[model samples]
Target: MKKLVILGAGTAGTMMLNKLYKVLDREEWELTIVDQYKTHYYQPGFLFIPFGIYKKDDVIKPKSNFFPPGTNVIFSPIDRIVAKENKVLLEGGKVLNYDYLIVATGTETRPSETEGLKDKLWYKDIFDFYTIEGALELHKRFKDWEGGDLVMCIPELPYKCPVAPLEFVFLADDYFTKKGIRDKVNIKYVTLMSGAFTKPVASKMLGELLAEKNIEVIPDFYLSSVDNDEKKIVSYDEREIPFDILTIVPVNMGSDMIERSGLGDDMNYIPTNKHTLQSDAFENIFVIGDAANIPTSKAGSVAHFAAEILTENLLSAIEGRPLDAKFDGHANCYIETGQGKGALIDFNYETEPLPGTFPLPGIGPFGLLKNTKINHYGKVMFRWIYWHILLKGRELPIEADMSMAGKYRV
Candidate 1:
């Protein structure tokens, strides 16, 4: 039987596995998946851990729980992908050859990439919510801590969940206020972007919200290093900001195995056809989610949308037909604002987030570009949807390609 190998059992890979498993002819194709970890993390839930909205138990489950029965799941680190040979070399010297390969190994935080970031003060004064350990540590620190200078910094771009830093500061505002230390806690949002966000309209809206919340926004600050001894983060231009508590989004990079494979870019992201989600170097290889160097938000929503398009394209390719399905780079995010409210944004490659209703042209239960309690509820309910529907390869009401029906230009 021809072999189909999937690398990385993360969200993208798991979704694809389920989607294809139901459709692929088991008699003709042998399906297999590999990953290094035994646990599956709800990465988005990590954002809430520091705020006590979620606990360690809420974000984790066995990797086996998500895999479909009869799957040839191998828990092992990948050494490298030999694309020309159509083979994957695992760390244990096991070799697997494939007729088709799907790379969904996602990006990861590299705190060490920034000087002094992972130093002695790490998990003491400095923490990152991108990882479970960091989030749990920060939660512990926040429990007994009196508020001081709480600084949220984004050291790089293309990080997972672009709105998370903003959400962190927003939630921090609420958390400290409830603790009755809001007055003592001076929250500052430090970002490398020119504004609160990358897009203009959304940035303006979020920037105004930050100001209203009395959260200082320091823009264009490129983080150079952390001065663990002095408790300050220094920027490339030599500006230093001292903080009592520093929460940061570290530099993110694709899997190291991508680097070894020589199939990746400077950042170790695979060169993929943005529209097709297919590797540019190999016709039989496809990349999904954070692994592909696609110009879109590296969030689960993008992966979910891309999976639908990819499923269609892959099946077409299997039949020796032209790949007709195209991904439109659709991404949507819920920005949690303080006080039980959140804002939503939906856009594709050609469109920036705009103001209007969502899913339904004029009658959305969830507002677009507007902060509302209902949007927060939508985000809260998504966790259930993620575990039950999304990972199971079930179809959502939303379309794969972005629709302009409910959005309006500002």
Candidate 2:
């Protein structure tokens, strides 16, 4: 039997396993998935973890629960990928050969990448919500905390869920208001980008909202290092922003194995054909999710869209046919804007977010690029859909390709 090996049983890998399991003939092909951890995290829920909206247990489940029974699930850390030999070497010294390989190993937070960021003040005054431990620790610190110079900063771009840091700032504003400490807190958002967001029109809208909320915005601040003792972030240009409490979204990079295999770019992301989702270095290998150096948002929705195209392309390749299925960098994200309202944005490689009614053009239950309660509910309801539908590889009502049907083009 031909071996089909998938690395990292996270959202992307798990979904692919389910999709391919039903399609690949069991007698002729064998599927194997490997990951170091036993538990799977609903990563999107991590955004709410620091706000006490979601407990750690609420976002975690056994990795084995979602995987197909027939596929071999191995809990082992990958030491390196010997791509030349078409094999993965685990930490335990086991070598697994593959007829075809899928690299879904996702990105990770590198707090140490910034000097002094992980020093004495880490988790005391500085915290990150990207990891489970950091979120839980921040939750505890936020409970008894009185407010002062509360700064939410993003060190650089291409971070997981580009809007997450903005969401954190919005949620923090609401949290402090509810705790009766809003008056005492000076809320500030510092980012490397030129505006509140990457896109110009959306950034303008969001910037206006931030001003109305009285949250200060500091743009074009390229963070060089953190001064833990002084409680300030120093930029490469020598500019400094002082903070009483700092919530940081640090540097994000792809899996270490990609670097070890010499198959990744400067940020450790594999160089993949943006439309094909196939590795530029090898035809038999493919990359998806945060592992691919694609221009789309490093988001779950992008991965879902990529999976649809990849499924078709993989089948075509196996049949010695041309791969015609193309990924258009589709990404849909819900921005939680505090107070019981949220905004939705949908776009692809060639398009920026625009104002529109979503899913059903004129009769949308959700609005795009505008804050609404319906969008908030959609954001809240996604957690249920993630475990029940997305990870299970079930088809969702939304189309895989970006749609202009419900969107209003200017």
Candidate 3:
């Protein structure tokens, strides 16, 4: 029987496994998945953990819980992917050959990459909400903390969930207000980008919101190092920003196995076709999620959309046919603006977010590019949807392709 191997049992990998398992004939194919970790994290919930909205238990589950029955699941660290030989090397010197390979090895935080950032002040004064441990630790620190120079800084770009840092700042404002310490807290949002966000219109809206909330916006400040002893962040140009409590979004990079295999870009992401999701270097190999260096948000919604297109293309390749399905880089995100409200944005490669009703355009219960309580509820409800529907590879009510049906073109 032909073998199909999937790396990483995270969101993207699990979704693809479910989608392909039903379609691929079990009589002719054997499906296998491999990962080093036994637990799976609901990554989006990580953003809410620091604010005491979610506990560590709410965001974690066994990796094996979602795998379809009859498929082989292995818990082992990958040593390298020998693409030339079409096999993977495990740490114990075991080699697994594959007829086809799907790489969903996701990105990781590299806090150590920044000098002094991981020093004595790391969890004490400097914290990151990207990981469960960091988020949980920050929660305790914020409990009794009197407000001071609270800085929310982005160390670099191409991080997972780009809007999370902004979300952190907004939630912090709300958190402090509840504690009656809003008057004492001085919130500053420092980013390497020139605007509040990567997209132009969204940035303008979000930037204005920051200003209205009295959150200082510092753009174009590239982080150089952290002064643990001095309690400041030094930029490459020698600019210094002092902070009493520092929240950082550390540098994000793909799996180290990519670097060891010598088959990835400088950031260790595999170069892939933007539409086909197939690796540029090999036709028999495909990449998805944070593993692919596609010009799209490395967010969960993108993975869901990509899985639909990828499954179609993978079948085409197996049948020796042309791949006809095209992926338009569709991505949607709910921006939590705090105070029991949120904003939603939907766009693709060619379009920026425009104001309109979503899912039914003219009749949307949810508005796009505008803040609403409904959007906030939608954001919160996603955790349930993620576990029950998304991971099961079930089709959502929304279409895979970006649509203007319910969106207003201004």
lDDT of 1 by residue, 313-349 (tens): 9999999999999999999898889798999999999
Residue-by-residue lDDT tens digits, candidate 3, 150-254: 999997869898788988999999999999999999999999999888888888889999998999999999999999988999999999999999999999999
What TM-score would each prediction reach against the true structure? 0.99, 0.99, 0.99
Model 3 misplaced regions, further than 4 Å = none
| Span of 10 residues, lowest total lDDT, candidate 3 | 401-410
Residue-level lDDT for 143 in candidate 1: 95
TM-score of 2: 0.99
Q: How big is the RMSD of model 1?
A: 0.8
Cand. 1 Cα-lDDT: 0.94
Query: Runs in model 1 with CA error above 4 Å?
Result: none
Q: RMSD per prediction, one decimal? A: 0.8, 0.9, 0.9
